[model samples]
Target: MFIDGRGHITLANRMCDDIFQADTSEWLEHLYYDCIHDHNFVLFIQYVFLTETHAHEQLYFDDGWSVKHYEAYGTPVTNSKSQLHGVVVVLHDITGVKRLEEIRKDFVANVSHELKTPVTSLKGFAETLLNESMENQDVQRQFLEIIWKESDRLQDLVGDLLELSRIETHNFQLNLQPIDLSKIGAETERLLRKKADDKSLQFNVSSEGNKEMIGDAARIKQILLNLLTNAIAYTGEGGEVELNIYEEAEFIVCRVSDTGIGIEKQDLPRVFERFYRVDKARSRDLGGTGLGLAIVKHLLEAHEGTIEAKSKPNVGTMFTICFPKEWSGW
Candidate 1:
């Protein structure tokens, strides 16, 4: 955009329409202050005109529904006399870059916090045992148990972080192949049934329709394990957990449901976000790294599949995942 010496918008480009969400053509001949409402942008232009030099700023424009980030550069237009004629401004969209930056920062912070918790516990307990040399064997054993548990939790957290990182990489690909959902469901049931039994929860798995599909068998099992484990962890004694495998149209569907502490309406959408827990304290107590659902979502995306989560607080939660019956690696 070009602002004249009188502060009027003398020229504007098509991109200005998109960046400012207004008709740039209509802005021509109008005063910059009248056309551009963003105070920071106005200030940036004014600074360039006042200093008769180049300036740049990162600005954000909010349009009620969403916010957009922009890198704006303003430079004074002048002739050989070095007298400023006007100010020319340009805006470059950087919303995606800004979002990635925010995500990276959040991820780093979360990883740091998660790692610190277990390390702190392990260090404190180990230090106490080393410094005190308690004569009571039970107290020593208790401290050792805590140290061991924290170490195990730390290992799990690291493993999950690595897995999530691998899945999120640009070059990541699924080991796609022909697989059977029913067999996978049966296997997962066998592996986790003991856990459910420990809580006296009624666990069941039923299959119908055609369960054969093309996917990464290991990842499919991982997805099931994550969902089933979460269901079991959140459910109480005498609660029920069910895994139903069937087909819908050209997709094979697996629905895992449990009478667990369900998520709130506002939190359901973010259940798949990394390190997000509906019950943070209880999830930590249950030895969850909070990356299961995030991994599940990424794995599903790799397979060109989808997962939907529905829940009613204090009633139950259900996850329905669908995989294409056939895949050509496209």
Candidate 2:
């Protein structure tokens, strides 16, 4: 966009029309303030004209649906005598870059906070045992047990972080092959049945149709393990947990449902986010690193699969995952 010496929009391009959500063709020769609805952009142009120099700023425009970020640069257009003619403004989209920066910051903060809790506990308990002379062996054993538990939690957190990082890397690829979902479901059930039984939860696995698909067997098992483990962990004593695998169209679907302490409506969407927990205290007590769901989501994405979660607080939660019957990796 170009504004004339009299602050009139002498020229405007289609890009300007898009950024401001207006018709630049009709805006040509109109006053900048009259045509441009974004006050910050208009002020940027005015500042460049007033200063008769280059100016730059980061600005955002909301087009009702969503907000978009842009890096705005304004340079004064002048004659050979250094007399101002107009100001030329350019906007470069930086929404993706800004979003990545935000994600990076949030990831770092979450990892640090998660690591700090266990590390603090380990240090405190170890210090108590080393610095203080304890007479009761039982009390000493209790401190040692807490230190060991914190160390185990820290190890789990680190392992999950590494697994998530590996799955998220650009070069990550699934070891796709012909696999049977029924077999995987059975194996996962056997692996976690003991935990469910310990809690007296009723656990079951059933399959119908053809449960065969082309994907990474190990990652598929990981996905099932994460979901099933969460079900057992969150459910109360004698609650029911079910794993149903079946074929749907060209996809193999696995649905894990549990009569557990369900997630609230508002928190359901973010349940897959790293370190997100509906019951932080209970999840920590259950030895959950909080990255299980995140890992499941990433592994599903790697296999070009999809997952859907539904729940009602104090009732139950169900997670349904679908994997394509055939996959040609990109």
Candidate 3:
């Protein structure tokens, strides 16, 4: 905005017309104080006009739908003799950058908390085993087992975090190729069937038509394994978990449903967030790092795939995944 010798708003672009949602002609005649109510911005305008000082500031404003961030730079208008006239302000939007910064902060905080729990447990168990538990074979074995489990938890957390970071980075791309959904489901069942059997939960896999798709096989299998493992972990004895492969229109689909302690409606939207757990204590007890779904989400995005989850409390959860039969990375 332009001003005379006085600190009044003389002119503004369409974007700068923040306070007075009016015509340019009307806004140019209004003073800066009349247009903006923010104390810092008003003070900055006054200071720049009076002292002819150059300034830069980052500010936020609410436009009707949402809040937006802006970076404003002020430069003085001066005569040939270097006498101050008024200040000209330029604004740049930086909302997206600010959002990424917030996401990064949240990610770091979550990872720290996730690592600390298992690390503390491993430390405690090792100390016990080295001291009092050393003479007691049963106690020592139990403590050692706990230590091993905690170590595995830590390793899985680290591995998932790294994979998520890789998948989220701008440079990452999927190694897409034709893959068989049925084979992946079969392998996942084979790897996790023992766990299901241990809990007396019935595990089954069925497929038809080969269920071919183009995507990263390893990432796809990882997603299925995560889902299957979670199913086995959460399902009670005598419950059933099924992995089905089929074709839906032009897409190959993999559906895994389990009769388990399902998620609540309120928690559905945020289920894929890092370190978010419906049951924190139970998740930790089950050795869940809480990054499984988050990793699944990122990997799916890389492959241009989609996943849908439907659940009802105490009933069960069903995860339906779809990938294009032959994506050209278009």
Candidate 4:
């Protein structure tokens, strides 16, 4: 659209009409203020003139069908006499790029936070042992033990974070092979049985129709471990955690259900977000880095799968994953 320095719409190209889904000629000669009713946007335009600089922003249209991510440049046009004419504003679409940038920034921030917590604790405990080596043998031994536990926690956190990054970024090549889903679930249960027992929780894994799916066994096991660990962490002692596997219409389905501290309605949406925890204090106390659910979300997505969560306060939470049947052969 062509507008004068006074912020009026003088002319609009056919492409602009198509992009906005607006009728031609009707929108012509309309003041820009009439089209943009958002107070913030009006202020943005006012700021442009007040500051005399290029400004860029995103605005959602009235119809809600599109979001306009535009960078507008206001340059004073000059006539033959070197006099200032009017500012010409150009708009570029960058909605997709903006979304990608936001995702990348969030991913980086989450990874950094997850890595920093365990590393910081490990470093502090290790330094404590070094500083008080001979003060008291018993105290020194306790500090050393703390340092050892912290180190192990740090190692697990780092390993899981790396695996998540690799899977999410597609940096690691998968050795695709056919495998039995039941067997995989069983193996996961066997590996985590001791931990589940230590917590006095009941772990149950069952398959519907004894189905088989194709994928990397190790990666699948990693997914199970992450989910189970998360469920167990949130669940109280004597709670039941169940892993159910089945075949859907054209997908393989796996659901992990736990009688745990159920997520609040508000927090359910953010559970998959990296470094997001409904109960931050409890999560830290339970040795959770807050990257487990995020890793599960990414790894499942990498396999062309989808994951969803449902929960109710004081009831429980269930995480369901659906993998398309096409991957059964891949």
TM-score of each: 0.87, 0.84, 0.91, 0.73
List residue ranges in candidate 3 displaced over 4 A: 18-25, 62-66, 130-134, 326-330
Which pairs clash in the backbone of model 2? none
RMSD score of candidate 4 (Å)? 5.0
Top of the candidates by lDDT: 1
Number of residue pairs clashing in candidate 2, backbone atoms closer than 3 angstroms, sequence gap of 3 or more or interchain? 0
lDDT values for all models: 0.91, 0.90, 0.83, 0.76
**Of candidates 3 and 2, the better by lDDT:** 2
Q: After aligning candidate 3 to the native by TM-score, how far in Å is the CA of 287 from where it should be?
A: 1.3
> lDDT per residue, candidate 4, 1-330, as tens digits?
555667776776776665566674676667767874556556666666556555666654444765656554444455788554444555566667877988899878877776677678778877777676477788778877877777777787787777767775745566668778788889999988988898899998999874666677787778888898888888899999999999988988889999998999999999887778888878878877777888888767667789888998778899998878777434
Expressed as tens digits, the lDDT of each residue in 31-143 for candidate 2 is 98988888888888888988888999999999889889999999989999988889889899999999999999998998998899999989998888999999999999999
Residue 148 in candidate 2 has what lDDT? 86
The full ranking of all candidates by lDDT, starting with the best, is: 1, 2, 3, 4
Worst 10-residue lDDT window for candidate 2 reads 321-330
lDDT of 3 at 224: 94
Which candidate has the top score in TM-score?
Answer: 3
lDDT of 3 at 294: 88
**Total clashing pairs for each candidate:** 0, 0, 0, 0
Q: What is the C-alpha lDDT profile of model 1 across 247-292, one tens digit per residue?
A: 9888889999999889999999998999998789988999987899
